[model samples]
Structure formats: structure tokens, C-alpha cells
Target: MAHPVRSDAEVLSVASEGVYHRLVLSARDAAPRVRPGHFATLAVGGPQSAMLLRRAFSIHRADVEAGTVELVVAERGEGTRELARARPGDRLDLIAPLGTPFPLPDGPVSALLVAADYGSAPLLALGEEIKRRGGQVGFILGAATADRLYGVEQARALTQDVLVVTEDGSAGLQGLVTDPLAQAVKAIDATVVHACGPMPMLREVSAIALGLGVRCHTAVEAAMACGVGICMTCVLPVVGEDGVSRFVRSCTDGPVFDGARVRWDDIGTVPPDLEGAAAMGGQG
Candidate 1:
């Protein structure tokens, strides 16, 4: 893992994408080290605001030559709303290239990339990387509506096989992304699956991939109060190689993890079977 850096990044552009905002920052030192699934945390509310915690976002694109990093921001709260209003000349405190990145295949392999809404940000980069490595890539992008679905055109540009699904019948298919996932995986003969989405979708994707005997990697959408792993706000129960379940910090250990190892159904509540749960008096 490359050492993360604290940089004062200048806003390069802020473009509106339907209900979301795309923020491009001039981050020279941090741009080159970013890989697919790596994230960044920005100080919101400026210097004097009461909001102390930073807002974390997945690195959408990193342009080493341009010295820029892009992030997709959804204005769900005041912090993000403030970030959306940033002008091209404004500067923001940024700590980036953090967390484990998606592990790429050593050789060309058929891979399926799955994402939902803005989660499409990271997987797009992953698909590009896979193509550059001489691998075949397919995308399954889902959202609640047509406006929420992202990267459909981009995914088509990357590869010929791109699937889009929307919940409200406003887009390609009117159903959950997982509805046709198994058939799609088999159709493409995918050897590995990479996903970044809501917890429920990820859980279903993991199960389908594992059930089909294919490797699956997922980037969890955990809320990190401190992106550098200090606050323990994003720890979740994950089974280790030794078969012991432990509460691991997502900020450092992973924003990306082996899909099979994550206790997806047991998320949010600390399972009593966790390594140190007995000492902490975790209830069943």
C-alpha cells in the first residue's frame, strides 16, 4: 500500500450529474498512487464550521498526467452540500489514496464489474484497468431510477457487454441488479466478480458469485468518521484466514475485501461470536 498524503487540493471543476455532483481536484502528489476502490476524505464546513468529521468519497478517477483526482458527491447532508458548492478556485483539505485497492488479475481473465448509483465511480476505473491488462470486462450498473444510474454510456464504451437495471422501470431493466446477475455471469463466463454497492446488493452479489464457484471482491459502503482508521467507526465483522471472525476497520484493512469472508448478514450488529465480543458483552 502506498503511504497516503495530506494535501491542500484546489478545485478544478464541479459539474452537476443529475442529482449528484462531480468534484475534480488538483491533487498532484495523490493522483498517481490512487487505484480502483481507494478513497479520499475531505474536511467539510471549512475551518470554522461546527462539523468536525470529514466526508469520505471513493476516488472516481485519478489523472496522473493532469495532476487531478475526481470524486462523485451526493448531497445527502450538510457536509456534502458544502462540498457541492465549491468553486474552481477554492481549496480543500484532502487526505487520499487511502485503504486497500481492488486486486487486479495477474493475467487476462473474464471479469464482471457490478455497481449501484454513484458506486459506479470506482468500478469504472477497475474495468478500464482490466481492459488495459488484456482482460474482458462487463458491467452491471443499477440504480433506483434513470437519473440515479451512472456510467451506462461509459461502460458501453469500455466494453460491448453492459447491463443497466433500475428499480422504477425508468431505464434498461425494471428490477434489482441482482435479478439477472447469475444468468449474466454465466452468459459472460465470468471468472471473477468485482462489486461496489449498497450492503444488501453486495450481499446478494457475493452469494451468487460464490455459489457459482467464482471469486468475488466487494467494496463495502461503510461510514468512516476518520478515513485514516483511528475512530473505529467503520469496523465490521470479517472472518479471517484462520476462520475466526474479527471486527476489522474498513478504512485501513479494506474498503475492498474478499466477498466470501465478509459476514454481510451480520453487519451493523457485532456478532457474539466475534473475537473479542465476549469481553465486550456483545448480545446475541
Candidate 2:
């Protein structure tokens, strides 16, 4: 899809829920350009601007009929804090529909959607897409605690079964969310496993999916300065079909990637097998 229309989008509303803030924007053209995993960048600077950087956030929800798009943000810093303070009718500049989206299966197939923390944002739209394709969606969502879990209620409403877990046993299950992923996929007879969350969680999910002999896709969470690939800070190692691992920018190449194709173990440090990666310890 083409990039989202850059506009002085109006803030329709702002609401706060446990561990997250939901901001609704009156960007009528945004919905048409966005897909499930695509994200947005919002300029939070005001006149005589104290904060100059635009903040990137995942598109949590959208209502085309209502002419609006929503973002679920965790106010961990100044940029998001300013965004959270926005009121109705405030104008915010935005660039969106960024990055690749999760691919839909060629044929309708059962899926297991996994979410950690606020990662549930993308899966809601993905679930709708799955149902539209005559497929079923089963969810396995987890967080540090029940209050931190993003969309358990919504997931339950959309599908027949949802498994929720929290670290302290404050919610459905007591252990890590990954603890039940394999069993959940088996129970649903899922063909695909889709995940979005912290790198640690994604890594574990990828491993579990591989062990179960299922296809997996992941949406990586990276901090982007430009969100449009203008800055190269979000690059990571991705293995291509030619058997070469090259650094690809997550903002444009993907925030979403084929789980198997991503060089998971070599993500943080470039591996020697890569064609031109520097071998600091020894010269080949």
C-alpha cells in the first residue's frame, strides 16, 4: 500500500487504559493506506518545540466508516508523554502506513495469534482478515500482570477461545505466555503462528513454532528515529534466499519478517558467515 497521507491530523479523542493510552486521530485517509502491522509517526513538537523528534507507534485500531485511526501507546518517555496529553481537536502531523504487513495465507487456514504486552494492537486487524478468509483465530496473550495485558476481552469476543497469562498469576495462567503456545496451536490445529512483542518473546515463539513444524511470522519492535527509513538506526540482520545475511532496515524492509528467514541468533551481532560483515577478531 502507498504511504499514509501526511496531514495535520486532528485528534478525535484520547483515552487511557491500564498500562496504555489510546489516541484516536481524525485522519480520514489513513485507514485506506494502513494494513495490520503497519505503523505511524506523529510529530509531537509544539510551537517553540521542546521535543523535535517524531514518535512512531503501531496502528492499534481503525474505523474507516468513522474516518479515524487509533494508536495504543505506552507513555515511557517525553515524546509519548506529549502525545498522551493531546486533547480533542488538537492538530498533530503524521506519517503512516509504514513497513510491511503480515502475509495472509494462500488458502484459509487456522492460525494462532500470539501477543505480548501491547502487541495485541496488530492482531485485532489480523484476526478480522483471517475470519474474512474463512479461517479461525485462537489467541495466546500475556503480560507482566493482568493490568498490563492489552486485549483479552476483545480477543474473546472475536474468537471462540483465548488463552491469557500473566507472570504473577494475576490473570488466566501463571507462567510465561509462551508456555502455552505449542499446546494452543495443537488444540486449534493451526497452520500458522503469528507473533508481535519484545525480541525475547518473539525469539521463543519462533523456536516453538519451528519445533511444532508450523510456519511463523514476527513483527519486530525497534526504535526508529525517522520511522520512514531516513535514519539507519533500526537495521538488523536478515537472511535472504541467496544464502547471504545482510543488514536490512526494519522501518522499510520490515517491522514484520518471515520468522525462519530472520537470523535470530545473529540479530544483535553480525555473524562471520555474512558476506561483508567485519570480523573484528580475525581477518579471513
Give per-residue CA lDDT, model 1, range 1-284, as digits (tens): 64789999999999998788999999999999999999999998878899999999999999999999999999899899999999999999999989999998888999999999989999999999999999998999999999998878889999889989999999999999998899889988999999998899999999999999999999989999998889999998999999999999999999999999999999988688899888778444
Q: Rate residue 228 of model 2 by lDDT.
A: 80
Instruction: Give Cα distance to truth, residue 123, candidate 2, Å.
Output: 0.6
Number of colliding residue pairs in model 1? 0
lDDT of 2: 0.87
For all predicted structures, in order, the TM-scores are: 0.98, 0.95
Query: What TM-score does structure 1 among the candidates reach?
Result: 0.98
Best by TM-score: 1
Which residue pairs overlap in candidate 2's backbone? none
Stretches of candidate 2 off by over 4 Å are 279-284
Model 1 residue pairs with clashes: none
Q: After superposition, how far is residue 151 of candidate 1 from its true place, in Å?
A: 1.2
Clash totals in order: 0, 0
lDDT of 2 at 62: 73
Against the reference, the lDDT scores of all candidates come to 0.93, 0.87
